[model samples]
Target: MEDLNEVYLSPLPDSPYVKPFRFNYTQNGKKKTWDLLEIHDSVAIIVFNITRRVMIFVKQFRPAVYYNCISRQDRESNNIDTKKYPASLGVSLEVCAGIIDKNMPVEQIAKEEVLEECGYDVKVTDLQKVLAYRSGVGVEGAVQYMFYCEVTDDMKTEQGGGVDDEIIEVVEKTIPEIEEMLQSQSILPSPPSMVYALMWFIHHKADKFRKTFERTCVECKVK
Candidate 1:
């Protein structure tokens, strides 16, 4: 096991949205220095509409991924995997997520993200902490909090009020469809943390999730 001799080097820039901290560390006898960018706490919601047997996901273009591929191909042409071409870098389908604003609560962020990303007005309940992960390890230290949210099928009947600058598209898929995508590796563009969290929910909470869907349908008369 490699022991880390961690020490705070200096504080970097501080902003309303993020605070950057510089640190020095020794890992495996090698000295290293890096900056950790801490953003306001955030929440991600996996909204499952049981009646439709579907989970809600959002699509957006990511510039980081777009440039990553070009850089990789240029640097390692011979080592590049041709099988992984036509990569869906920009088109990432992920669970609803957003940063918690300064004064807003975590649950509020979760609800807001669900509505913004999927056009769903869902009561964010049964908030299970899925995982905390560093979104961009190499460049940024954006820690993301993920959760599972139960939503009604009619949540998307009206126009979704997403952020003004965000070009988001809502996608709903069945469990079997998600399984097929996983098998086909078509979900490569999604964040691995979210995929793993969804897998955990499927493994641990599938039965209860199904029951919730049935109850929601019964109450809404969406038969």
Candidate 2:
């Protein structure tokens, strides 16, 4: 999936998802203008799979991540060499997430994202509210609603790899493996929301899940 080539830069075109604007204001008798992007609020879900005893994440290529990593000279030249940089640098491991484009509740959007991105059919009530925070504070400053959900093998309706032209891979990591990543100095490229959600899970839900898993294993062994 990391076979990326023929990368180039282009000017920002008109889009419904993003709108750039300049705001002028007077502060202490000085007039100043700041540029910002008007973007839709988003929802992120931290999915824990009880059947597999792992956390579910979605891995996908992010254009902005790729654009920032390549050499400026290569970017300006409109051609990027796959040998030096490699496309893996552009891929990121992120929680199940989506933009709030429809008028439905954020919980419903989060539910759909889990099913579409991770192949988990969970109910809206299955999603527990985590916290809401502002993302892209400088440029966009859009509110991102966060949620947590647990799923089992029964919820797997299909191989959720995203819809339309999106190419996403579902990744699963055990708790110990994730903890090892947390201790590593050079972790993989991931978003702040994913890290925060993992930390929240460790602090709030990890122990309970671990105990339940251990008890279930012992019960099965005894049986």
Candidate 3:
């Protein structure tokens, strides 16, 4: 994944995910114009593995994120110096998520993502709706629905690395580890929805998991 070579940039072609357009509007008798990108809505999940006292996440390389961090000259040159900025810089640790391309319920989509990206077969009813909000308001203002679900070891159906061309890595982080990342001063290469979901878990579910962990430790000591 670290190897990046012979990279080139081209005009945005026909794509299923995004389309660019210019919008002209009149407000208070004043003409206004804005550049916009129409994008698909998406679903994200905050997955907790109660059996392991850890949170499930996914790590994958994003081309947009990678492009933004590299030098403009390198970008325009159609070549990047991997020695200067490695491709690992573009890999992000994020929650299991997917675009809402299907006509099914959003909850179902979230459930499928859990299985497809994280290998957990969670029921649709188990997907508790956390909230929904607009993402990328400056460009493509698409709605993103967030959900939370808990999984046990028994729920694991496969070693999910995503389907088709997706090269996702399933990551498990303990509460303390995630807390450290949340408190770190350095920027984490993750999306806003992922940060918000982790904060939500720390506020809502961390204590419960800690209590269970403590109890299990005590039981082990007594034995």
Worst 10 residues of 1 by lDDT: 1-10
Ranking of all candidate structures by their TM-score, best first: 3, 2, 1
Cα RMSDs, all models: 10.9, 3.7, 3.2
The local distance difference test score of each candidate is 0.66, 0.87, 0.88
Q: Measured by TM-score, how close is model 3 to the native structure? A: 0.92
Two-way lDDT contest, 1 vs 3, winner: 3
> Across residues 1-223, which tens digit of lDDT does each residue of candidate 3 receive?
5566666678878987778899999999999999999998999999999998899999998888888998777777756777777889899889999999999999999999999999999999898889999978898899999999999999999888899988999999999888888898765689878888989999998987885444455545741
Residues 1-223, model 2: lDDT tens digits:
7878877667779989779999899999999999999999999999999987899999999888877787767776766777887888889899899999999999998999999999999999999999999988888899999999999999999899999988999999988777777777764588788888888988898876674444455545741
Model 1 deviation from the true structure expressed as Cα RMSD, one decimal place? 10.9
Q: Per-residue lDDT for 1-223 in model 1, tens only?
A: 0111221123445567556678899999999998776666667787788676688787776544543655544434444332353335446777788877758667767777777777777665645667777776675766788888767766665566367777767788777666666666646667776677678767866656453444456666773
Estimate candidate 1's alpha-carbon lDDT, on a 0 to 1 scale. Answer: 0.66
Of 1 and 3, the candidate ahead on TM-score is 3
Q: Arrange candidates by lDDT, highest first: which order?
A: 3, 2, 1
Compute the lDDT of residue 163 as modeled in candidate 3.
Answer: 95
Off by over 4 Å in 3: 211-223
